[model samples]
Target: MREVAAAAGVSRQTVSRVLNDHPSIRPDTRERVLAAMAELNFRPNRAARMLTTARSRTIGVLAASASSLFGPASSLDAVENAAREAGYFVTVAHVSGPEVAAVEAALDHLMAQAVEGIVVIAPQQRVQDAMAAVSLQVPSVTLHGAGLAGDDGVFVDQVEGARLATRHLLATGHRRIAHLCGPGDWSETRARRDGFLEEIAAGGEDVTGIVSREGDWTAESGAAIGAELLADPELTAIFSSNDQMALGVLHAAREAGRRVPEDLAVVGFDDIPEAAYFAPPLTTVKQDFAELGRRCVARLVERIEGVGAVGGGGGAGSATGSATDSAAAPVPPQLVVRASA
Candidate 1:
């Protein structure tokens, strides 16, 4: 600022006013400041600006990816776009494990950077529980979180989504079914599995012959579990908690000499980009994960700007199992019909 003011033959205050676009600055004076800034290759100091304006204009993301899953990865990308569009920069710290120490360390890393707000996104219940024990000092949003204190959440209705898939299969007269669930620690794994069982009970289907298998949310795990489940010829359908595992089921069925929707049916969650191009396109539940991330950032900004009530701040207790109860609207899931089912 000093160099620019000196080159422009104006006071530092005049240069500051020009930088902030104050309307009172004369046109010629503004032009001179711009020319001086260009000549000196001057860049505004973000730290100094924050000191003067009390705004960092930057948010932090603490994202977890237990296995490089599609949901967390997609959310990070969407958050970057949304924050940039809202005129803020973003910093990210990834939580590679479900341990409380990992989460706390990541939080500390972000907080030390002077971020004005934070976004916490982890799919595993254990991780969310871990986050609940730590106190956050800034406004925050959680995605698929346990609704830790001082944080609002944004999520898709995972249980209803699973029910949608299961309901569709039962409505089509397929009674003997299997459920390929994700890792036991993940919140999604529990919600989706419950939905499958609930819908099956609602349809009055006998549970004796149904197959339930747990996978590590990878295609290889899916194929392994699916192969054994497919050994039973009575199992006419399978509903996977995620699309990757669904792909593995398709592979297993193919190797087992079964034609999808002809000999057996399949349904999956999270309609990833490649679902439509599978050997036989997958029928799966679609969550607008990108939109979910965008809305989360928007809501966090509201809290950061002090526009509304914040969750559990100032030592208020925490809450969990947030569905439609969060400050932000829940993103509904849609079932897309394709040849697989």
Candidate 2:
């Protein structure tokens, strides 16, 4: 502070005001102080600021070990970037399992860091239930798996994404459509399964019945399920819960000497980067994981700053300056059509 003040010909108090973004500082003075700080490579001490303001300027992220998944990993990156832009640091704690004990341990770790708020990437029903049971005191937001929006949460409308994928198959004249879903414990699995079933029922197809199987959201599980589905010669299309599993279905179809689109059309969720490069290319739903992450940070910061309600009163909106406004409809995932479906 002293070096920047001396270099900019201003008092230390003036430099502090500039650093804190005080509106009282003159425009020219603020510019001069910023320039001096940049030239001197001066950085504010977070510890001193915390002592003065009683704020750690840090946020906590609670997530499962599914960081290897495309959606969760991408969302984490987005949260980190948004937190940095907001002059806050992020601390992430990954729970090794879906049990309540693991969730409590992760929360305890974040609380020890004195985080101002928390964001939970909870895709499983068990994790959500655990979070609800813990009764977190700090302002918190959840990234829900189901499409239902929470007062303090944001989501990508997974049910609608599934509906889009299923409707596409129906439009293509696929009557015997089957669905390959994730584990029943995951909220995403139930929501996607419901959407697929609803759309199939809407078609009024008098086929034998709905053929569904659960997988672990992996290519291997998808391949095994796909192989089983291939035995039903009447099945015309399959909708896997995610892109990774869809890749397995593709491999199984090829191994069974089945032609894609012609013999068995397939659609998957989460248009991962590799989806387009698959053998026949993949038709999948694209979620804005980045936007979801940004919104989580923005909402949590608002709660921490007392500008938004704590817990589940309000703030189920997108971040300010985001592509969508809070008053507008929730962002919907897009279906990227390719040769596979």
Candidate 3:
């Protein structure tokens, strides 16, 4: 510290402020100090600082889905980047399933590492319940879970996304719309299913016998279900919970000798990058997973820094309230239309 301070021609206090990202430091002075540190190869002792400040400057991430999933993987990357910018390290624990025991084990691992807070990416209701059951001393936030009252979390509005897809089909004059949903245990599935139903009702369509099927959020499962759904000739359009399922519906449509948008229009959610490049160019809803990650870290850090209340309360942290507050509206999803629908 002394060598860098001398090199930068600044006092030790100014150097410290610059290192801590204090807003009071002048930009020129901050740049000079950073240049001096770079030249001197000065590396701050994180362990010694933790002892002095009683803060590990580390955040934990517990994800129920594998990193390969497009939404979860993108979210995880965003969290890591945001944490790094905020001068904090991240530790990840990927649970194999949403089972209570699995979640508990993942939490235990993160606790052992002494992380300052935790961010759970929960897609399933079971995972959300498990998180509620645990008594956490550290500040925690859930990503993608239903923002029930009294829960600290941030989520993409799955219902709104579903509504967008369904409305698009309706606007295209397709009344006999079918729905392909994910597992019933998932909060997203329920929200999307309800959204589809709500839209159908609002449109005054006679959906007395509309078809609905459940899939495992895999292209293969989608394909299998799609094949079965194609058996019904009355189904003029399909709203899939995700883009992968829409791809399956396309495959089934092809095998059944039905042309897209001519015989059966298909809409999907979560417009993954490849959605635009599909054979028929799928129309899907786009959720900002990266923004969700950034918000999750921001909320968690606010609670850790004592600027925000934990769970169910409002705080002056960022534009978005504390993670646990039900009042905070989730980031909305948008629809990207293409040839398929």
lDDT of each: 0.81, 0.82, 0.81
| Global CA lDDT computed for model 3 | 0.81
**What TM-score, computed on C-alpha atoms, does each candidate reach?**
0.81, 0.89, 0.89
Better model by lDDT, 2 or 3?
2
Comparing 1 and 2 by TM-score, which wins?
2
Off by over 4 Å in 3: 40-43, 148-151, 206-211, 307-327
**Model 3: which residue pairs collide?**
151-324, 152-323, 152-324, 153-323
Tens-place lDDT digits, model 2, residues 6-71: 999999999999978899999999999999999999999988998987678888999874888887
Candidate 3 structure, TM-score to reference: 0.89
Model 3: per-residue Cα lDDT over 1-341, one tens digit each = 99999999999999889878899999999999999999999998988778866678999999887677777888888889989877899999988776788888998999898788888887777787887677776777777754544545688888788888988888888878889988898778888888888888888745532646689888888889988888988888989988888898899899899899899999888899999999899999999877787777877877777632323333223324434454457888999999998
Residue ranges of candidate 2 with Cα displaced over 4 Å: 26-28, 149-152, 206-209, 307-329
**Per-residue lDDT of model 1, residues 179-254, tens digit only:** 9888887777887888788888888736422646679888999899999999998899999989999999999999
Clashing pairs in 1: 150-311
